[model samples]
Target chain A: MTSEKKIRVLAAKPGLDGHDRGVKVICRALRDAGMEVIYTGLRQTPQQIVKTAVEEDVDVIALSILSGAHNELLPKVAGLLKEQQAEQISLLAGGIIPDSDIPYLKKKGIKEVFGPGTSMNTVIDYIKNYCAR
Target chain B: MDCLCRKISEEKERWVKTTLNKAKCDRRTDENGEDIKVLYTPDDICAIDYLSAIGFPGEYPYTRGVHASMYRGQPWTIRQYSGFATPEETNQRYKYLLKQGQTGLSVAFDLPTQIGYDSDDPMSEGEVGKVGVSVDSLEDMEIIFRDIPLDRMSTSMTINAPAAVLLAMYIAIAKKQGIPSTKLRGTIQNDILKEYTVRGTYIFPPRPSIRLITDIFAFCKDHVPQWNTINVAGYHMREAGCTAVQEIAFSFSNAIAYIEAGIKAGLAVDSFAPRISWIFNTGSRIFEEVAKYRAARRVWAELLKNRFGAKDQRSWMLRYHTQTSGVSLAAQQPENNIVRVAYQALAAVLSGPQSLAACSYDEALALPTEKSVRMSLRTQQIIAHETGVTDTVDPLAGSYYVEYLTNEMAVKINKEIAKIDEMGGAVDAIEKGYIQKEIEERAYIIQKEIDEKKRIVVGVNEYLVDEKVDQALFRVDKKVARQQAAKLKKLKKNRDGQKVQLALEAIRRAAEGNDNMMPLLIEAVNAYATLGEICNTMKCVFGEYRASGWSGR
Candidate 1:
């Protein structure tokens, strides 16, 4: 375990979905788990999220979309990250993601998909495992 | 081999005898983070004064319910929150719901409309009709309830930042229908404090926003006496990751701020306090949720009577509407959400909610379709009709566990309220990001528990399903934005531009002065001033609120 280095995360709500329960929950959970989380308030575009991720130099970017606009929004964010030369940072998606969309998202460079009911531990564990590797 | 045998024998002995006496028992904690005993006795509630804590229903300090025979005399209104795409579509849905036994109408505006943007505004691109119905101008509002009688039916609008404009449109519609504004009975979710802390749909900053809230209170007190001016909401706050105690505390603090604002505006406590309502979320925590509602009533009663010096019994009574928590639904094994919603609805019924809205099972995945929405309505109907749970007033009132939980919740919430009061008030707490940070921390702990398997959420971390279920979900039309934009452009071209401009100028003048804004807003809507134009005019006076500290630490 890194003794003093803070676990940094970028928590963003993508797409036009304004419902923020899941995103807020994840943000709280990550913070409680001793991670320094940066939450881009609502209605953040993919470009904005990517820019913030790069500037903040976050170790993880957790994107949440509930309006079923993930298929359109996530790819843009992933592409922006690559274009900005920030592809080394891990990308995670959450909030009502469908099983069918998981493999496709993984292919687009998203590391994992967290659907509804994903516990805070699962997220922390995922981050720890990925970061450790 | 001898050592291994001895270790095995010792372990067996420890498991069989020693561990049985020292095994940890499961202790339930309420949403407020208070520990609940495994068994509660009458001793737990010995301190509660029967006369003060729970007087007769419909009397002073209405702890049982606001009404004597709550569901027995009249059933709680099955108010469903529904809206979509265009004005015409939402109108049809309203008519359909009314036909399907929904007593009252609750309107949900899209994000753009909620934040005071027109359908054609650049900021509103790709979001015209994604979440809820888009109402750009008075024309759209007129189309929304074309045939529905404003006087006969109560309409509750879930709006915040642009609530003043929307309320004006409704009053204008009432005038066009030959119904005086005083005859209208409905509610506007003009609770903007929650918007800043949790919902994030705010327009102006805190000071000007409270001014707008006071403006509505003053207007409704004189003209629309029957209308509920503000619904101090804990629903969105709970959905945004606050615990149950925080929900009650923050919501009551907000209500107190509104009461103080009205008093500051030179209104009597009794004049507007009766019309101020509340909205809360009924979550998956069954007993805890019921206790929350009960505690909420007691707290509101004490605050209004003792703190605000409200003498009117009606002013002291707490009337609330509850919506099942949409966050509790699961996308995996979606059918389980039906059970979850049923329990939540049952809790709301037992908690003596004046009205209730049960979220659809498929809400976690997408906007509910017709069938899913029907199922949600049926869930509430079953509790009201089939289950016989609503036969008595506060059925779970005397249960030892419930009473204990209620008292515990009351104490915890009072403490939280005191904390916020020390930080100046709700507005100050919001500006300093105190409440937001607390909610964030609690939400994270809950999530972490789930992740660690310390909390079991069925069909998610456990009872894994390999197959997917086929369900029909609501899908917005792809061309909705383009079509809405075209309609808005046509509306601007066809309407009387001179009248719209004058109406906007009048609004700006009223906003600049210390004048009540409702009448000016009504005039603007009457002159066909689009929502965006009126909002832009206000924005010029009261600058837009930019959320500070977006980067979480």
Candidate 2:
């Protein structure tokens, strides 16, 4: 393993989804991949997550929301990232996103969407490829 | 023909020599240090005693199960955990669940209610009804179970930190219904120790928290004999990234601590041990998950009888509830969650849980919509009715592979328990961040395996396809917060202010003295003192617990 600059990721659970098994698993997967990950516990607001993303200067912001407020919440986070001029940070999201919402999320600048059954390798590959690009 | 033959031969050779070869490999170690054996065999379980280890269901040590008839007697209760928005809305949901043939009601309170913040508290802003049902006062609790009979239906409230307050409120509601407190049958997830390690919704330090728990245990034994004062949980810890063995070890350690605390408070083991229950998370690993449950029962029985010197068989038996793993559900291909949940539920039933909560298929995307929740309940219904898995108790009991794994699991878990005891128990381990760090490390390793493609998660990294489907997702109304805040304000306006003050002061005095806080808390709940107000009063006296090391800098 190269001792290169580790790809830093902010794994955040926005809104009030107290069910966090998927998020915890993903967080572990990313950390094991040798990426520097900051887990901001649970019940974070979209604004709080964006604020943390900016403060941590993370290379990617991964939002884990199973709370069905993704349509309202994801756009807000994307908007705040732009307003804060942190658009360089790739936005990735996981949790149950309906198929119809993927294009909408993509339109809002979420570079990749890793849904259930998406292997950790795919996420790691997507981040590595997207970040390099 | 020659060119086609050559290409075909090359493809066939590659599949036969490499792909098939790799597929047959055994015992691959994942990043989390978990061994993924190709297949478990009788040889793997050489140490198990057929009669002793895989005992008849509902027998001593309860390795196979606690009930000999198991699900055939009565299929595990289908208990769905749901609460959202305001008490009125939650009441509607509860009524709907009861109508859907759900055997028991499991309530989920919002963060504000859990942390003892009033609906109008600054921290409660924008989060009043986002996650769970919001209960600001006894008025809210009265409305939550409004027309429902507390005497008829068993309820499980998934609340900690403010668990005693909520329990007191339930008791007050029961008293108002002319039902003696002793007749109520329900459970409070008074598992505060797990909160610090995994769930993170804690109010006071370990000492005062354990005191609060012991107070409830002591009071319940004498008063609400039918009520379960605490549900020692490994569900959150497993969801938080612990291995199956670690989950059992950590949760049992927590249970031991609670027992020690109760004994210290001058209570006998049999007085409340039967009422002490467990909640575990059933995951994707079908056999491993089943083995974990069976192993848990055996470990608990040994610990209670041998270690604690308990004479009562009821004190030795481990009764538990199982919830499908929320962590295994994915955001993509959300429908796949249905199959995953079915497997988890099946594991729980076959492993022999007292009750099971199947997670909704839409859980990965949002709070479950009515349709999704129904489907979840239906999944359990199908297993109970259509499948003959329930016809036999511990159907997989005699399998050499299962018995061996159960024994191996017990040994591994006992080792961890010894480590925790050396560290002065679960509370001490949690305080020192040992448990938290270990879980985080394990979580990291599991993820690493997936990142490297060592673990195959269908629809996520492999067998990929670009397809999308629309799912009905639940959205919390923005109006929920405003409505809840208004109700809190109105309750404050109408309730007797002086009685509330006296009740609060009584609670403070009880906290200082050796008196149990339940009776005073019941009085406060009856006076319509808001949950936040009661918690704030306790916080002032007890102070909030911050992990000694986590400055977050």
Best by TM-score: 1
Q: Model 1 residue B496 lDDT?
A: 91
Q: In model 2 chain B, which range of ten residues has the least summed lDDT?
A: B544-553
Model 2 docking tier (incorrect/acceptable/medium/high): incorrect
Q: Give a tens-digit lDDT track for model 2, residues B367-421.
A: 8998899999999899999988988778887676677677878888899999999
lDDT of 2: 0.83
Write down the worst ten-residue block by lDDT for model 1 chain B.
B1-10
What would the DockQ be for model 1? 0.37
The positional error of residue B484 in candidate 1, measured at the CA in angstroms, is 0.7
> What is candidate 2's CA lDDT for residue B20?
67
DockQ for candidate 2: 0.23
Clashing pairs in 1: A28-B444, A29-B444, A119-B451, A120-B447, A121-B451, A122-B451
DockQ of each: 0.37, 0.23
